[model samples]
Target: MTPTTAPLLPPQKPFDPRTATIAIVTFNRSGLLSKLLDSVLEMEPRPGHVLVVDNASTDDTTEVVEGYRERFGDELVYRRMETNTGGAGGFSEGMRLAYELGSEWIWLMDDDVEVIPDGLARMGRWGERFASVQGRRYDFDGSEFYWQYRLSIPLGIPIPFAPAGFDDSGYREMNSGCFEGMFIHRSVVERIGLPDPRFFIYWDDSVYGWLASRLTRSVIVNEFVLKRTREIKQWDMGTRHLNASSDRYRYYIMRNRGIMQQYFRAHGAYRPALFAVGTAATFAKEIIRLTAVERTVRGTSHLFRGWRDGLKIARDRSFQTMPPLV
Candidate 1:
């Protein structure tokens, strides 16, 4: 609970949704995207704007979003990237565009999550208090989704298990973040820069949130602001859970460590020997999960490959530290 010691700014103001822009990054899953749009349409007070960043989906995603154009008008914007840049890239584009639109706050999400009627308004409650914030979410089964509030960047792990019931403050300080429902102020973006697209997928949000925590008081509130529209097969691990993953997912899960290593080293949090041990331990944990939970190492080779590639990435001298937007 005492992990993040960043100074809380004084004289915070209440957040207003009308001054915030919602950015959803989508790659296929038009059905889920449509439902999310419908949910966004019903959000109270309404957002300043909704921008859908299409990651060159081959499906009818364009048509699905186009259907809502008449009702949304200029309030809705759609930008299709020429190439599929993955979740990390799409979010980077979304945040940059949303900032260009001059919105005071930028809310980032994946298309798979449906917005709650009062989601943005709920986040707005903490707008004046903190520049960066995340809200709670529910799985499609209507169960509370488990998200880590604090992360141990040096070890590349979360500091705690599930939260102890949201507590008295109604919010918990967070160093880890979920892109599914991250609400952040433009000033924070200006101070820390946008989410790095190089991650391509995994650990991107965690690093971004941790960096934000370094600059301001970033928290995850008690409010259920988003509901995951898709269901993931997961194994119950005590109060926490591990989502079943695919080969692609597994590759990124480990391979992205390369990108994370560079960032952590740049921030002075990476210790060579400690990071190596932590990474080896991470590999072992995944192997144990595959053997005990899934009972199969079907794509285990990819994990090894990703680990090798990630090491290569970590040592690339061309890698540069993330730059600030200002």
Candidate 2:
């Protein structure tokens, strides 16, 4: 068993009915977006509010949302961005809106998902005692565990498949699976703000959760509530090069991680040197592990670019900025 520490939750305060609002960012995915909305609307206790930020999708995502508005009434609020602000930008807007609307918590997710009913019910039960916690669940299968091929560890570790809370307080760093659905408390957001918009894609979720963990406690519940499209999973590990899309993600992952380590160091909380080394090695593994077919066909270059970009970003920015996700 992992030695666990209890999270220092914010001072006990009166529970507000509208404690949390669900926020999802959508871009060019109409079909998946509809399913995600359906799952949340089906929640028993239901979200206090549901907000969607349309990132200038060309598709009729707005039409789908209009249908939901008629059915959901005031329970759902939709915002359309004139330009595509990417995932980080959309998340920032959604979270900021949640705070302004008096949400005690914000449940964040991408549009390509479907929440299991029981998973949400369990999260509510955990929220009673904890300020902010992420419910653990399979990517698609609720009964089975979700697995991922990783570089840090030789064999891929299962995404926390357990019964209830499994003492995650000791886990200083954790990944939010596929960045689908995770419950975050308002207090954590009030302290950490939203994800860094500079990280348009990758590492934004990790950066947000890292800061939140510093402010309050976070946990991964053992209940599944999301499914990734076939293409989405492939895109996650698609490249390691620095380009308009892929390279930017690599840059942020490397640079933001350095920023995280430095933040801890400044607080007199120096982590193991292996922590940084291991991270870089894992990224390298991600680059090399690609099959021959993938290399020739897909042109996977994010790993090499990540190393180069990590150095550049680290050299440029030493500490994370306040009012940013840090």
Q: Which parts of model 2 have CA positions greater than 4 angstroms off?
A: 1-17, 141-178, 227-276, 292-301, 317-320, 324-326
Q: List the lowest-lDDT window of 10 residues for candidate 1.
A: 1-10
| Top candidate, metric TM-score | 1
Q: In model 1, state the lDDT of residue 57.
A: 98
**Model 1: lDDT of residue 41:** 86
Tens digits of lDDT, candidate 2, 152-231: 22111212232222354422234332346667777666665666666666556654655565555555555555555424
What is the alpha-carbon lDDT for the whole of candidate 1?
A: 0.84
- Give the TM-scores of the predictions, in the order they appear: 0.94, 0.75
lDDT of 1 by residue, 210-238 (tens): 88888788888889989998987778776
Please report how far candidate 1 places residue 111 from its true position, in Å.
1.0
